[model samples]
Target: MEEVEVVVAHRDCATLRVGAVFLKIDSDQSRTEVEVRAMALAPIPTPEIRWREPPVLALAALPGRALGRLGHPETASSAAWVAAGATIRKLHDAPLPPFPERSRADLAAEVDGECAWLLANDVLPAEVVTRNRELADPALRPWTPVFIHGDLQVSHIFVADDEVTGVIDWTEAARGDAHYDIATLTLGHQTRLDDVLTGYGPGLDPDVIRAWWSLRCLRGIRWLIEHGFDPSLPGGEIDILKSRM
Candidate 1:
């Protein structure tokens, strides 16, 4: 066996170290990665900024050969959609006994603060800011909150041989409405969600799904306004939000 050396050491709230592997890694490590929660900084109303801890999951690096050389495929098969839904269900069912309790109002306040900062920094257009406020104004009803992987997207997911092997990046994980997670997935996949839910099995209400879809659109709009429009975000996403306004 050869010794591996660290080639990159990147640190933010959580630390990530990439190294050269000397030999073949096992499947278990690839299947089940380590999850670490780290404390991150968030500005508050006070003169001083506060530290808030967010969950961060560590993922094993994929082998060079296994890496996808092309962008996300435009179409996913029905089976692939089902597989993605199952992966999300497993994540939603994960235990988080020590997670902090937060209300919908609390989340709205957080979003408001973020929007304010973005506007102050001239990151978003005035129209976008106004639209965000309108969408965030609706009082969110109290529902059974679950452990949501705040930023669930295709780029953060690891798939091999058409199976979702690992879900990565938990920096945004929190106890919130399940609709948030559903929305995140929908925004990333767009029109393909119908296929996903088809594989998502029965029992989900059509009304609830529609609600989740609306919330997802709102969240994506907020993200784009705050972070500036990234070329990578789906064109349909921007169009949907504009249409909603």
Candidate 2:
């Protein structure tokens, strides 16, 4: 019998791994459309599309292991992290996808909303949330947008030896602040950042990246909690917020 594993299940979407194929079932058809389109536009390797019908997108799993899980140490070599960075550089250099506009003001409002939820729910201590909010203020400044993966979590990247084999999950892909991708990649694995930056080349502002780190952590906590995932997991969302202080 072929093994069938549920990768994740939520009101918005569910992902399943069966044998060598993965099935993504999204409640929103538009998100699936954007994902398929983004994968086609990315300059780097992405999962091969097997079939698409309505809300279900079947993809052939890519070669190699994931770079790492979120909120955990990455066992992949520093070179692999560097290669991942180079892959992102290539994607950012590609033609921008025609996604809807994303504004810093919109992001600030979202952050403010999520932060409010966190405090009201007591998801994180007030001081932690307040400090990270202050840190995130700098990232609210204007930036030159680029083609970004939108959700460049480490698990989305796959690697073999020292090369990036493919990147998965493009639903959130958009033309947005470049630091968003960079910050997403190095969210919990700060130690691997030097290697990634080396391959990403120069002129990236450290403050912006740091600020995005705080912003993403704060922005994601409420959603994760509402979705039934525990953000309090060790080295998870809460840890990411504390690390920014």
Candidate of highest lDDT: 2
Q: What clash count goes with each model?
A: 0, 0
lDDT of all the models against the reference?
A: 0.49, 0.89
- Candidate with top TM-score is 2
Provide the TM-score for each candidate, comma-separated.
0.59, 0.97
- Model 2 clash pairs are none
lDDT (C-alpha) at residue 62 in model 1: 45
**lDDT by residue (tens digit), candidate 1, 91-173:** 55666424565777776676667657657766556686567456645435567766667666555555556666555455466
Q: Candidate 2: where is the Cα deviation over 4 Å?
A: none
Output the lDDT of residue 55, model 1: 34
Candidate 2: C-alpha RMSD to true structure equals 1.0
